[model samples]
Target: MTASLVLAGFGFGSVAAQEDATTPRATLRIVHGISGGPEVDVLLNGEVLAEAVPFGTVSEFMPVAPGDYVIQVVPTGQPAEAAIVQADLTVEGARSYIVVALGTPDAPEGRVYEVNLDEMTTGMARGRFINAAPDAGGLDLVVAGGEPLFGDVGYGDASDYIDLPPGTSSLDLRGDDDQVVSPIADVTIEESLAYEMVAVGQVADGSLTMLTLSTAVDPSCSAALGLGGAIEDACVRLTHVAPDSADVDVHVNDVVVAEGLTFATVTEFVMLPSGEAQIFSVTAAGSPIEEALITTDLGLDPGQAYEVLVTGDTEDLQLAITGIDLRPVPAGQARLGVIHASPDAGPVNIRLSDGTAVVEGLDFRGVSEYKAIDEGTYELQLSPAGDDQSVLLTSELQVTASIVYDIVVVGRPESQTLAIVVLTAPVPVQAEAIASPVASPGATPVDASGG
Candidate 1:
């Protein structure tokens, strides 16, 4: 005889009254026929009664209304196959019944992994590290919307973990020395859930540094201030306020025109020729503040000077200004340089002053060495291997005679979709500066080591 059990209803209300007004009621005692592991599911009348049941256990479903009802026995973790029994059984007011749950064949086992985060000490921020991509190296971590609890520190290993004060936060994991990574945000690090950080490196180089040029404009001056104008004309005179001595690069539009100008005074004049309208940009070489562009129009005059106050974007960070000059390039030459924080490798071009291409097919690694060519004043453009991927530098570089200049490109990582972290420029070669009989027309190719 099968070992069956009955489930008698022990309640204050009648089972028949609890059922649909016209339907009868029944009580059920379900039992599993065979089981090694305690994993089973019981469903009654098309509704799942229990999720998982223990082996050889008897579960009671009291006061079940009787009707054309179906009973299903499903093995845990297996939903495709189940045993069903359909019968029309009526239950007397106090009658009890038994339900035999026949077990099916066992199913295959699945795998899962658990992730955990260690509790952080007080006053410390909660932090985690992940290695999503197994291949790349040098991940850049960015904390958006707030300052990092821990200042600029490198995470060397892919699978390594870091500690921070427990709280809700988002993080980005980038490669190429933090130049390219993924942003992971809105991660709720509950006291229970273990946080797993993944690190994925960028496929290409990452943009590591940004050069920002900040200059306050006089509200009264108006003349469409920028970096381009007539030959031998002065665009804006920028007074040097920091780093008594340093090297600077001047950019008209986005194309670099001159570099390596040493400055040792408080006032520096940046000269631009007339005829073309463009924005003027400047940046220091080998300094943390490497690139800066003029976003506002300078409304410059031929011989007027613009006083620019230099300050650090953050406290404790030094404001170093290098290189300053006021000059114009001769016609037929174009000034050029690499975009400091660009993400890809490709050809860089310059529109000449004489409706011709001054520099063509110039290749640059982001953050590498920059070169300048003597092309007449026109619009400068940078294209990355294809016509669809080109960014026009803001101004036309008015080329004049005899004046050498530097152009610095400033790109910020936060503003870009892709980040490049590796060094893209050629290695700089060391050489002594030899006095040439005549200064070169465009950017004089300095020793590569100077990059």
Candidate 2:
């Protein structure tokens, strides 16, 4: 039988697909921790397991039968003969493993470590450290103002799992001489879970950083089971982009969460329990839920991030939900996506100034996948899908390294309030600073409509 697979957000949760309890199977995942590396694909016995996985991104857990198999890693799109790393992996039944592709871009290596999923003491967290940093030799994983959690970890070595108290604390990677190699700030160690602290990148080039991976079923989902629910929280953000709509109050499940939210504003991520239908209502500021202008029932999945856009004019407003991928970009690159949210704008096309199409025939409420691109400034043209001659907007898009950007096409066509609003995902604090001309504000959205 084929392995059961489940898509995950930031790699959380257990085997979602149902299987026989007596079947002997193992779950496996791949972590792309190679610093400054090109996107790579993981193949198991000639079948593509994970495709085009960029640096610092984790693959979804896949269950496979217990056996010895040929595991290979190659630059994405390359043939099997071009494999950079290849080995035989023996997976045992009823266990989980994380195969990390580490080292530099030119010279890569792979290491497999079994995750600690065994039951542990209450009120404690289990963690381990892996030294993937090629140049940083003999490192120590320590909690700030505390003793070392894992010490003298050599390159490519994995430490045994250790239990720690649940709390928030800063983490540090120190060198053999007791010098700090990298400091990870405000890491939360939740009770009854396990984590992998991987030290990646090169010390000489100042690309040293840490990647934290969780290997547990989300606790929120467990808590939901106790509350007669079956799923974890879904991360939702609200963006008020309907230019002509009056200031409004937003309600979820009959509770007013945002009041007097005006145009061009957005709410932080709201954690709402999933596995049930949720009522979302919008009304005039200070108005009762009975007077809601629009009410809809939304069912969301656990462990996913979604952006809900309030679009169109007040008379014919609508809600549009777009899923956001929070995976990290590879070193020296950026992830960009486009959302067609304008009410009056029909199907549109986005192209570079040189007439290269970036997105084509994207209709209202359509969302594009986040595409990776090199860091630079470029002129972009937006126009009606079929009629390319009549350009609707022209603007410069500035993007920096290691950032994710989502550009929303907003504003009504008649009132000429058409524009593009940019939303950015936070950069990884443990990342090395990429030397680029782009300033701190990595991406800026220009007024495409000349408003």
CA-RMSD of model 1: 29.4
Residue 111 lDDT, candidate 2, scale 0-100: 75
As for candidate 2, its clashing pairs are none
Scanning candidate 2 in windows of ten residues, the lowest lDDT window is: 429-438
Evaluate model 1: give its TM-score. Answer: 0.19
Q: Report lDDT per candidate.
A: 0.34, 0.70
Model 2 ranges off by over 4 Å? 1-231, 427-451
Which candidate leads in TM-score? 2
| lDDT for each residue of candidate 1 in 235-305, tens digit (9 for 90 to 100) | 33333222232566545555454455443222233444322344545566533223463232334343332
The clash count for each model shown is 75, 0
The lDDT, on a scale of 0 to 1, for candidate 1 is: 0.34
